[model samples]
Target: MNKVELVYRELLFQALEKNNFLLTQKELSNLLSMSLSTVNLSLKPLRRMNAIKVNPMNLKTINPRKVLLYWASVRNLNKDIAYQTRVDVSISEIEKNIPANCIFGAYSAYKFRFKEVPADYSEVYVYADSLDEIKKRFPSKSGQPNLFVILKDVNMGRYGKITSLAQTFVDIWNLGEWYSSDFIKALEMRINGILE
Candidate 1:
């Protein structure tokens, strides 16, 4: 990289040395005290060199080790970006293994068909068809995005874990006479997993 390119790379790397892996282009520009265009121009070469992969969204990530190296080379700043990267990877794995489509709602169903699941069962459940669907549907999870995938099709969003309380009730009511009474009762129990 050229002198200007290296300098800008250092600036970008320095800002990401901390635990905050989600750095925006605007934030990087602000921290580097350089124009956004300058920052973007400077970053272009490093990215071309395979040092960084830009995801121009609310949450952007890069290779922490390379970033820290650039930081040290330019500003003599040493930081362990590996730890943050590890955490991000680990969190991603955990979010990938949840189930899809179950436990939507049960308000009227609760009072009429299955009055077993207490009001505490008020949370609405969100599920998906697959993991790729999640990344495709919601690229970056921003503030209160209200959507999370325990793994692919399995999700916890809107209300997190459960969707709106209202939806949960509606689903239960709709399935009232469809499934067996014992089955619905079993669902009220945390252990009853039909998907399993």
Candidate 2:
């Protein structure tokens, strides 16, 4: 993921998870290790969409859904795929076999985050810093991919276990599966509940 997406992730995480919608550019820069200009650039769309109020001292998120959809629109989840393999095992077994260091994404992310599956899903996606363990476990197969390992960003560690709400939303938005829409609808309801 790019630095701009990282800013959206942090901002959404704060607003949705932490219940803190206001932050200064310097604080965001420090949290994501980005420059002030980069953080400023990331906020431009939010500002234009009237999703945030950017005062001199701080920025307040007024519409997190707008921010989320903006990120989802710009997110390139496919480009972040670091490794892909056909894990023929059941989805549960495949999830269990994932490396401990990985952060679950896509279908598995919705299950982990919400403790329920919106619909039956066939694939598992994860973000991992290294693929050695996954490679050893899943190996290679000849069929279509059921497991995808996304390249983990340096700042991803801030969200433990599963990917953050924004990350999960954007990732699911990029998927083509029919059940992916189910997950997206469930997530939107959940996010609306949180941000309400």
Candidate 3:
């Protein structure tokens, strides 16, 4: 993920999860360890889309959905794939065997976060810096891949077992799977509920 995406993630996380839509550019720069100009560049699209109102002192997010969709539109999910292989196991078994220090993403993330799945899914995505354990467990095979390991960014900061709500939504939106739209619709409903 780029620094700009990180800014979007933090903005969405604050607006959706924390319900604190008002924040400062300097604060974002400090929290994300980026320069103030980088934060400004990231907010450009949102400002143009009328998703946020920026002042010299603080910026207020008025349309989080726009911010989310913008991030989803630009996110390159496949570029982060560090490892992928065909795990000839049930989805449950594949999820169960994911090694420690990995963050669940996409379908698995939605399931873990919501404790319900909108549709049945066939693949598992995870973010991890280390992949020796995963490579050993699910060796590369000459078949369709069911397990994808996204390379974790060093600056991706802390989160729970699953990816952040914004991250999960963007990741699912970038997926080409047949059921990804199902998850996207379900997540939109959930996010709308939260925003309401």
- Deviation of model 3 at 131, angstroms: 2.3
Error of 2 at 48 (Å): 1.3
RMSD of each: 21.7, 0.9, 1.2
> lDDT at 92 for candidate 1?
27
lDDT of 1 by residue, 1-196 (tens): 1334333443333433233445566776665455777767766755765556678573343554454344334431111011111113332232343344422223322333334544332221234445464454345533433233222121124233342232232234333244434433454342223112
Off by over 4 Å in 3: none
Which lDDT values do the candidates have, in the order given? 0.38, 0.91, 0.91
For all predicted structures, in order, the TM-scores are 0.28, 0.97, 0.96
Backbone clashes, each candidate: 18, 0, 0
Q: Tens digits of per-residue lDDT for model 2 on 110-145?
A: 898778988999999999989898899989787999
Candidate with the greatest TM-score versus the true structure: 2
TM-score of 2: 0.97
Candidate 3 Cα deviation (angstroms), residue 124: 0.3
